[model samples]
Target: MRIGVFLVAAQFPGMDSGDVLRATVETIVAAERAGFDDAWIAEHHFMSYGVCPSATMLAGVALGRTERIRVGTAVSVLSNRHPVALAEEAAILHHTSGGRFVLGVGRGGPWLDLEVFGTGLERYERGFAESLDLLCAALTRPSVKAEGEFFRFREVPMSPEPPGLRPVVACTSAATASLAAERGLPMLLGLHIGDEEKAEMIGHYARACPKDVPAPGHVAAAVAQVADTTEQAVATLKARMPEWLRPGLAGYVPVDGRPRPATDVDAYVDRLCRIHPVGSPDHCAERLRRTVERTGLRHLILFVEGAGDPAATLENVARLGAEVLPLVRDL
Candidate 1:
């Protein structure tokens, strides 16, 4: 039951992107003091949705600030990136963090990421496999040489090597989750699925996982929040919270004439109640424990307050860390 802070880098009103960057690093500093185990950064780009486009670069900043906490990408979009560059950067970050870096890889998303990159979704799965295979090869052996449909590497040794968690790659979709298991990699799940989905996906990984593997397949779910009261917590979530969500989001999101996401907190809550973990400290802790217990998920990454108001969001985090996290320490 280890707790981790996943830096979603959600935007706040009147705060510059740089301000959020500083806030993120400071939050990690505070989280370390609060006795957190690991910290993760997400991969999002070309939108106001996420601030840390270069997740590894920001992770390097965290490396310089913290001494013992582990750091890595919540996901490094593998499809849009070159395998060689991904390997080199992660290796450098690993050295920067004294071997505390673990690479979380993904094939980006279905529409927004793939469409933005001008790549078709039909072969997306194949590209994901290709990218993961290439990146892993580059990280493990020196003088890498390989060729695949989408990526190629040759005569390149990933110097100095990444330590601690070693070179790990993960993807979010269920099929990809099985792929991670096939390759003996850890898996990161999106925050917006139900209990049944969690059980089934995690179970899929476990079933496909090899018994002799060093580390068994892992499940990291991204729904976390803490507030003084459940009522107050729901109040803290803003009207515009759903606006920050990607347009390519899954589920029954109907149009409501606001260009993108409209005033659909009803539709929003339909998905959110399943994905976003929010509640008072006591309830939050107990619910989180139950979710993990049900799925046996070890890595828990929390996105506090749903990301609409940063100040209120931080307040939620302060309360959550102070109360809820302590309650779940042994559970």
Candidate 2:
């Protein structure tokens, strides 16, 4: 099983984005040394939260810094980028990571990006799906004419194309998962739902995935911090979580700009724990094992760093790779 971590690129008031950059690269190097499989850099904009903003640029950084430890966008919001740009950057990441790149596709925060890209929510939904379709076509198919509502192409072959057995495409939403399955794409789920929702979401994804997709539905289950001590993990998470990682913020924060995320940490945790995996390695591994038994997930993505001191956070990464991973790897 492949194990990866979430890099929020969380930035504090006085914090330098460069620090996160250094930490991220160092973490990937360490992950490679520790036998971890991949590093998933999340994208967020204008928030003090995970500040990657650009996955391909970071992928470039990762390529220059690490020997292995595949680097992938935890997801690149499809609604935010053009398919050509996506294909080009992914090819760059593929080259940078020695072909160890996974394309994490999603229709995330259509509200924020849609406006910037001169689109509406429904348009975002459609454009995101279509862009992913063209992206896959650009990557593998030798020649293609991708004409859709938001994007169109004719005889454009994205070269050095994902450079492999079709780059892994992990969809973020059920609708997007349907889009993926309809086109036989791999699925990557965000660990952001209740138990029933999680199960149902996976069900939809699996039902949508075609039997002919290169790999069986590739499911990635995301979870929050993994530590030796659950108590410590929770405390650290609350203290240091970036703005964007806050739970229910989207549901609460209206697009109309009404004040929201108005609740305190307790409320946030109550809602977030419903979606994220937070506990000691044993507890986390137990949950993961059960989920895999039920869903047969191909990868387990974790958010190893919390809102804590840098040293402690890195230590947590080391601990999870050294301690927690062994318990669940063979399960």
Candidate 3:
């Protein structure tokens, strides 16, 4: 399986945006030196939750700094930007990166994005689906005409034509999974859910995928921290990860659109660590092996930064490269 680092680029309290972004670039550079296959960056806006407001911009910075290791957006929210604009930028990025750019698209935070962009929430899913369609077409063909409920374009020529743009869709529900399958796009699953939930999501996608098309590649992401012992890792996470795992972090609604069991902060943290891959190098390797075996995943992206101090995070990355990665590189 391919191993990648997922950089959240979150600006913690007391840190400036410049510091956070510089740290993220350094992390990617470090990951490449540590023999990682890829570095994925997350996009967030108007919040310290993630300081990389534009993941595409950060992708450029990462690509400029590193070679061999692929760099991509963990996801560029489709609802926030115009499809034509995004396609144009992605096409250029794909060429500039020497075909190393992977455009991971998603429909995330309809409320915040829509409110900020002054779009209606009623068209959230439809607009995103349509935008994705337009983007896919633009990436492949030279000129295209699109007239959709959300975006309209006529005789648009895709300059600097994208070659082999392998877009990955980030899915959180059965509906989104089916959409990704219908488009024959690879998936980027998040670290939020449990094994049973993941199995169900994968099954749904498999069943819904068209038979004529090749099976889509599956990727799973998780928050990971490796130390000499499990206790050390847990303690580090417990002290430093509170800002990221708050109750409303999942958004206003449960991911599955159903009522969720009420839980306190400590319970939530416990559940998150349990669901995600968090432990010593040996233990993390075994857990990731089990996850890959169970899900038939092609790639695993670990969120190895932002959950702790810079020193601790860097130590985890080094240990991951030296101790954990060797154990599972061939798996």
Candidate 4:
């Protein structure tokens, strides 16, 4: 029932990176004004899919600009950075933001990012658990040491001393979901999957979680656009979103020189429109409520920027808060 906006800083066709970043910040501010509970910043590298390379850095900007809304990384790619380094940034943000920072980490794809960052494909393929374990230790323990396969370090005291931080893991598979459950951390489900898949993942987490740990509330990401009528909302997204999606989806490059799957941009958009809350306020609210009921998701982060237009995106955020939220807040 806790609603939020997912900021991708997506560079649509004919838009500059600077403008996209500024608009993303503006969206975060608008989200807080519109009564959103959180703003999740996405991290992408070497692509027009998302220009923001540093989710934590953008999160700092958002936290500084907004007082009430919690700021988090949709994911800081753990495969590309040292876990201790990310932990330090998380701790600093948590301390500075008065515990309003949520650290969400993920094992990014086997993209060229691994090559550029020099982490190699092995890190992305087999190093996530070690990195995640080190990250958790860095955040919770006063002093941390690691002797894992991917990382080996001497004991070092945590600076800024993580203010009781509990990171959310971005889970794309049962293995990842079980890993998160084993650590007693919640999962951040992506926008690509449907309710049934998400419910299955949650079931995996529930079955794998230790008896000593209480069930963690999971977060779900979904596309949302609000308009006076269903036709208007669907039309707006269909027209504007493909402009952003076509190039963005084609930007990924595999690290090992293997060909990546081609995404059918229009077909993907159509799928999202069918599955997500993209319609009139009443319809959007009902869709969201159904999603919550079906998946048992406690938090919902809506991709309000699906229109790929700043003004329309802002309007969507405001309308979502004003009309859609009231109907679904109690769910």
Top model number, TM-score: 4
Q: Write the per-residue lDDT of candidate 1 for residues 146-179, one digit (tens) a residue.
A: 6776655456656766332434455446678777
Give candidate 2 misplaced runs (Cα > 4 Å): 12-14, 117-122, 161-173, 211-217, 224-228, 242-265, 270-277
Q: Which candidate, 1 or 4, has the higher TM-score?
A: 4
Per-residue lDDT of model 2, residues 76-171, tens digit only: 767767766777778777775667777776667645655666656665645666776777766666666766777665676557654543444555
Worst ten-residue run, lDDT, model 4? Answer: 158-167
Can you tell me which runs of candidate 3 are displaced by over 4 Å? 247-263
Q: Between 2 and 4, whose lDDT is larger?
A: 4
The estimated TM-scores of all candidates read 0.85, 0.84, 0.92, 0.98
Clash-forming residue pairs, model 1: 143-157
TM-score of 2: 0.84
Descending-TM-score candidate ranking: 4, 3, 1, 2
In model 3, where is the ten-residue run with the lowest total lDDT? Answer: 247-256
**TM-score, structure 3 vs. true:** 0.92
Q: 1-331 in candidate 4: lDDT tens per residue?
A: 6999998899989889998998999999999999999999999998998999999999998899989999999999999999999999999999999899998999989899999989999989999999998888888899899898889889999997866688899999999999999999999999999898999999999999999999988899999998999899999989998998888977788999898988888888888998899999999988898898898888999998988888888999999999988888788
Local distance difference test scores for all models: 0.68, 0.66, 0.79, 0.91
lDDT, model 1? 0.68
Candidate 3 vs candidate 4, lDDT winner: 4
